[model samples]
Target chain A: MKTLTPIEQLPLFTTQIKAFINWTRKNALWPLPFGTACCGIEYMAVVGSHYDISRLGAEVVRFSPRQADLLIVAGTITEKMAPVLRQIYEQMPEPKWVISMGVCASSGGFYRAYHTVQGIQSIVPVDAYVPGCPPTPEAVFQAVIKLQEKISKGDTPSQRLVAKKKMAELTSGNLENTGS
Target chain B: MEYHFQLVHQIKESLGDKAITSVETGIGNPFECVLVVRREDVRKIAEYLKGQRNFQYLMDICGVHYPNREQTLEAVYHFYNRDQKQRVRLKVPHKEGESVPSLTPVYKAANWFEREAFDMMGLKFEGHPDLTRILCHHQFVGHALRKDYPATQNQVCDAPEVFSFPPLPLNEDEDVLTNQRTLVNIGPSHPATHGTFRIYAELQGERIMRAKAEIGYLHRCFEKMAETHKYQQVIPYTDRLNYLSAPMNNAGYCRAVEKLIGIEIPARAQYIRVILNELSRIIDHLVCIGTTSVDMGALTTFWFCFRQRENVYELFEALCGNRMLTTITRVGGVYGDIDDEWKRRCTGVIKTLRETIDEVDRLLTNNKIWLNRMKGTGYVSQANAIDYGFTGPCLRAAGVDHDLRKAEPYYDYDRLEFDVPVFTDSDNFARYMVRMEEMRQSCRLVEQAIAKIPDGPIQVNDPKIVLPPKAEVYTNIEALMNHFMLVINGIQPPKGEIYSYTEAANGELGFYIVSDGTGYPYRVKVRPPCFPIYSSFEETITGGQIADAVATLGQFNVVAGELDR
Candidate 1:
C-alpha cells in the first residue's frame, strides 16, 4: 500500500464533482474536540500558537456537534460518558469522521478500572487512532492529514460499511438463486 | 496540643462515656488527633469541634474498607483548624448496612464528601440530603471501591439524570404570583465547562435561584486503579488528577510516599522538585485566568496564556520526553536532571510570561464589563469559605492570609521569599486577582529556586528504593541484582498510613496512603482540593446571575479528574 501511494493512480469510477467535494472537505475539516481528560490539555496545545492548527485549515473548532464534520475524541471516555458520546455522534450530520485521540480513547491506555470504557470503538466507529499517552500536537496533525487522505479517497467508515453490506447482500442473493 | 486532648474529653463528657471509643495521637500519621468515635455521635462531635475548638475546616470525609476487621467499614472524618494548624481525624467503625450520622448538618462541605463516601465505600450516611450515587452513574449497581467488587467489572448506565428543582416557594415580596423559573442544564460536554461536569441551574429570568452540579462523567476510578497497581505505578495516575499542573500532583504523591517510607530525598532533588512544582503552578494559574477571561468573551488572554503554557510544556518536554502528563517525579527524586540549557529555557519562559501577564492585566483589570460582571457576584466570606472547605487561591481571595507553602513550609518553601496575596471581596473578580497575583509569585519562586539549586544527583542514591545506575547494572554483578530486585519487588516499606499534603496549583492536594507492608497499596484516597470548592459552587451562586456562576466556575479551576477521584 505504501508503494502504491507513490504512483497515485486515480480511480476511473469517480466524477469531477465528487473529486471537488472531497478536495474542499479535505482542506476544511471542522473538528469537535470531545476533550475530557489529560489529552484535552494536549488538544488545546494543538490549537495553541506554537502548533498553530490554522495552517492545516482545521482551525475552526466547533463546540456544537451539529457544526462539526470531524469528532476528535481526545481523552478518556468512562462508561457513564459513553452514552453522551453516542448521542453527540448521532446528532452530527452525515459524512462525519472520528479521530480517536490518545491511548485512553483508543485502548483505555493504562486505566483498566471499573468506570473507564476500555476503548471508544465499542460505541463509535473511528477513522484514525493517534497513539501516545497524550499524543503530541504534531502526532495529532499527522492524524488529521491521514484522515484527509482517506476523506479525499472517498474511503470513509460509513461508506465502507455500506459497501460491505451490499457485497454481503449480493453474495446471499447469488446463493439463493443457485439453490433454487 | 491542649485542643487535641480536650477534643476527646469534651466529646466523651457531652455525649456520655459510651460515645467515645479511644483516642490515638500521631500513629505514624500527620493528624494530631485520631479519635475513634461511636457511630451515633458523628454529628455531635463535628458540632463540638466546629463551635468550641475552631476546627472550622472539615478537610475531607472518606470511607475505608477493611474486609477482615470486625466492622468491615470505617468512615474517616478529617477536620482542620486554620489558626492552630491542627488536624483531627474521627474514625467511626460501623457495619456495611448500618447508617452513621451525617456531617452535613455541621460542615456544609460534608455534602459531597459524604455522598462520595456512600458512592465508593458503600457506607451509608443517615440524613445525607439526596444521598444517591455522586461519582458513578445513578444506575451503578455496586460500590466500586469495596474489596469484594472486581476492579475491572465495568457497568454501563446510559440514562441521563433527571434533574428536579424544589417546588416553587411562596414569597410575600413576589412581583409575579405564578411559578416562572426555568431549568437550564449547562454541561457534561459543553465548551464552557472545562471537563465533563454538568450544572443544573434553576433560573428565574437571568438569575440562578438554585444550582446543582452533576460530576463523575470522567470518573476513571483513580483510587480503585491505584490499589490494584504497585505504589510506584500510581505516579502516572496522579498526573491526571490536575493535568494542568501534572508535576504538582507528582510532587505531592512522591512526598506522601517519601513520608511513609521515612526517606528524605537529597536537597538537590528537593530544590529541583520545588522549581518544577512552581513552574507547574505558574502555568496552572495562567490557564485558569486565561480561560476565565475567555469565558467572559476575551479570547486574546487565552492565546497569550496558552503561548506561555506551551513554552513551559516545551521546557518540561526537554527535561522529560513527554509534554502534558510528564510523570517526571519519582518515589525519592525526579525522572532526570536539568542542565544549563534547561535552566535558560525556564528563566526565558518565566520572563516572557511576566510580559504576557502584564498584557492580560492591561486587557482585563479595569474593563467595565469585567468589573460589572464579576465584582458583586458569587460572594463567599472568609468564614463561609472555611465552612465550605475552600483552599488555595479561592481561600486567599476571601481574606484568609493562609498559604500552605508559608504555613507548612514543605521542601524549600521556607527559604523562598514570596507574599500570599489576599483579597477581602471574596467574589469572582477577587478570584481572578488572586490567581493573577499567584502567577507572579510562582514566577518569583521558580527563579529563586533555580538560583538556589546546587549540583547533585537528581535521583536518591538509596539502593533499596531506586534502581542502580545503568553503567553499574551493565558491569557489576551486585548492581545487576540490585536493579533486578528493585524492578521486580518495587518499593516496599513498613506497614503504615500517612496523609501527606502539598500545596498544589489549585489547592491542598493530600494523599492518604495506606501501605500494608507490601509494594501494592492497601487503599489510597486523594484529598482532591477542587472537590470541596466545587461542592460549594452551587451555594455560592444561589440568587446570582447565571453568567456569574459560569465565571465563578472557571475561576474555581475544577479539574474533573481531581474532583471525581
Candidate 2:
C-alpha cells in the first residue's frame, strides 16, 4: 500500500475525484422489484407507502429485471424457478448487488429439502444475508442500508475481479456439477 | 337427517347388495360413507346422481391409493346436492392404466378434476373428451401421487423428448399466411401470471380457440415434501402454497392434523386463529379486487387497495414478527399471542380500512368505463359455474349459496353473524363485487372476534402436541427437552386420516392429512381451489374477447403457488 502525500497526490487525484463524483451520482440506484414469494411481498411493503425505502434513493420500482442495479433474491428458489432466477440475475447489468432477503433465499429456510435450491448464493454471490423466515420490511430496509454501505466503498475490488473470473469458473463448475 | 338417510339407502339400493366399504362420521357434518362400486358403473351411477337424485355439483374428484387392499386404486367422487344440501361419496377401483368412465358428460367440472386425477394418480377417464395433464407439464411422466412412486428427486425420470414447434418454413424471411393458427405462449414469463405460469394459447386472429394453462413451473411437490418434514414443520410449507392468503393454508393444515389427533385448542387461540384468517381473507381479496381493477384499466384502484394492504401487513408484522408467509399459527395453535397494543392498532386500522373501502367502491364499482370493461365480460352461466366446480367468490358470483363459513362453520364461524353475498350474473363484474363485499364481511368478522376474545390461554395444553412456551423452554430442563424433541422429530398423531376445509380467500382450501401414527404425515393432499378455477379458464373464455381472459382469471385470484401445488 502506498502512502498519500497531500501535495503530491492532490493534482494526481483530481481526475479520480471527478470520476468518483460521477460514479456516485449515477450509482444512486433505483431498484426494480422482481419479487415473487413471501420475501417479494415484504420487499414491496418496504418500498410501499408505509416503510418507504425510497428515502434511501430506491424510489423507482421497475418491474423489469434489466434496469435494476440491485437484485434482491427474496424468496424460495424451487427447481422450476432456479433457471429463471439465474437468467434474471444474469440479465442484470454489471456493478449489481444481491441481498438474500430471507431464510429461504439465504439457505432455503423450512424447505431446505430436495426440491429447493440449498441457497441462492449458489446461483448469485450474495452481498448480504437477511436472516429470518421472512424478514420484516424494516430488516429489508436495513439490508438495503448495508448495500448502500457496500456501494460507498467506491471500487469493489473483490466484486470486479471475481465477476470477471467467475464466468470461466462457473462454466467449468457447471460442467463438473450439473454437466450443462 | 332426511337427506342423509335417503342418500344412504339410495346408495345401498342402487349399488346392489355390496357392503359399505367405509363409514366415516368424524369428518364434520353429512357424515361420509364410501361405497366401492365397480369401475364400469362409475359414470352410470354419477349420471343417476346428476339426472335423477339432483346431486348436481361434483364437489371434487380425488384418487386414493390403497396398495395393500384387494383393489389397487380408489377414485373417489364427492357429490353435493344443490337443493337437499347433502354430500355423497362414491369410491371405484381401477387397475393401472385402465379407465374409469368419465363423469364429464354428467358434470362438466369433472373434466378438469378427472384430468388432475389422471395427472397425479394416473387414474384414466375413458369417456372424457380431452384427458390431459392440468397441473404438471404435458411431457411429465410418472404418476406423482401413486403409492409406489418415490417421493424424492432420486426417483429419476428418463427425460422425455423435448419437442419444439417445427420452425416456420422460410421463404427468404418473407411472412406468409400459412392458414395455421399462431401459437402464443402468454406467460411463464409475463407479469400478469403472478407466478411461474404459461398459457399456451392457439390464437385465431386474437380469439383464443384453445387456451391451455401449462403450470407446474413452480411445482415443489409440496405433498411429497410434507411426508419428509414433521407434521408441525409442514405448516410453513402451506404458507408458501397460497402465499397471498398464508394464514388460511396454515390454519387448514393445522386443523387437519388437530382433527386427526383430536386436540382441542383453547378458546382464545381459536379467536386469534379466526382474527388472523379473516385478516388474511381481507388482504387476499384486496389483491384480487385490486388486480381485477388494474386489469380492467383502473390502475388507481390498485393503489388505494394496496395502500390499505400495507397497514394490514404492518399489523401482521406487529403481531407475528413476520408479514408475508407469516407462519403465524403453529400446529396446535398460533405461534404466540397478540398483545393489547397490536389489538388496538388492528382495530383502528380496520376502522380506517372501512372508510377507505367506501372510497374505493365509489371509484370502481359504478364507474361506466370500469363497468363496461367488466359488465357481461367472461360470463359463466349458473350451470357452467357449478359444472366447473367453481367455489368462493367465483361460485358465489354466479348466485351459488355455498360458503364454507355457512355450510361447515369451522372455528366458531357459526357464532358470528355475517351475510354471504351472492350475485346473479357470474361475470367478471359480479365476481369483483362479491370479493369486495366479502372483504367487508371479513372486516366485520375480525372486529367481532377481536372484541369477543376471551381471557384464556392461547395454545392448547398438550405438551406432547404443542411445545411449551419459549421462555419456559429456555429455563426449564423438561420444557427444553420437549422443545428439542418437538422441533427435531415433530408431533405424532393417531393413525387416521382427516379432511378439513377452510373458506380461503380464493375458495375451499382443504388439507387431507393421512397420519400413520407417526410424527410426519404419511400423505398430505391439498385441495387447492385455484386448480379447478383456472382449469375452467379455456371453457370460460372460448367466445369472449381477448381482454376478458385477464379480467376473468384475475377475478379468480388464481395464485400459481396454490394452483400448481
Best by lDDT: 1
- For model 1, which pairs clash? none
Interface RMSD of each: 0.9, 4.0
Q: Which stretches of candidate 1 lie over 4 Å from their true place?
A: A1-15, A159-180, B1-3, B16-18, B27-31, B169-179
* Alpha-carbon lDDT, every model: 0.88, 0.75
lDDT of 2 by residue, B1-565 (tens): 5555665577668776563444455354445544567788777778777888887877778787778877778787777675665666677877766788888778877887888788888888888987876655444567777777766532222222132343546565543564456777665555566556667666667677766666666666787778777888788789988888888888888888887788777888899999999998998888888767766777777778778988887787777766676888876788878889888998999998898789889998889988888889888888887777788999999998899889877889999989999999888889989988988998999999988988888788878888888899989999999888888778988886666778888888877666788787877878888877887887787766666677777877888778777
Work out candidate 1's RMSD over C-alphas. 5.5
Write the residue-wise lDDT of candidate 1 on B165-208 in tens digits: 76876786876735478889987998889789999999888898
User: Which 10 consecutive residues of model 2 chain B have the lowest summed lDDT?
Assistant: B154-163
Instruction: Please compute DockQ, using alpha carbons, for every candidate against the native two-chain complex.
Output: 0.65, 0.24
CAPRI-style docking class of model 1 based on DockQ:
medium
Q: Give the interface RMSD of candidate 1.
A: 0.9
Best by TM-score: 1
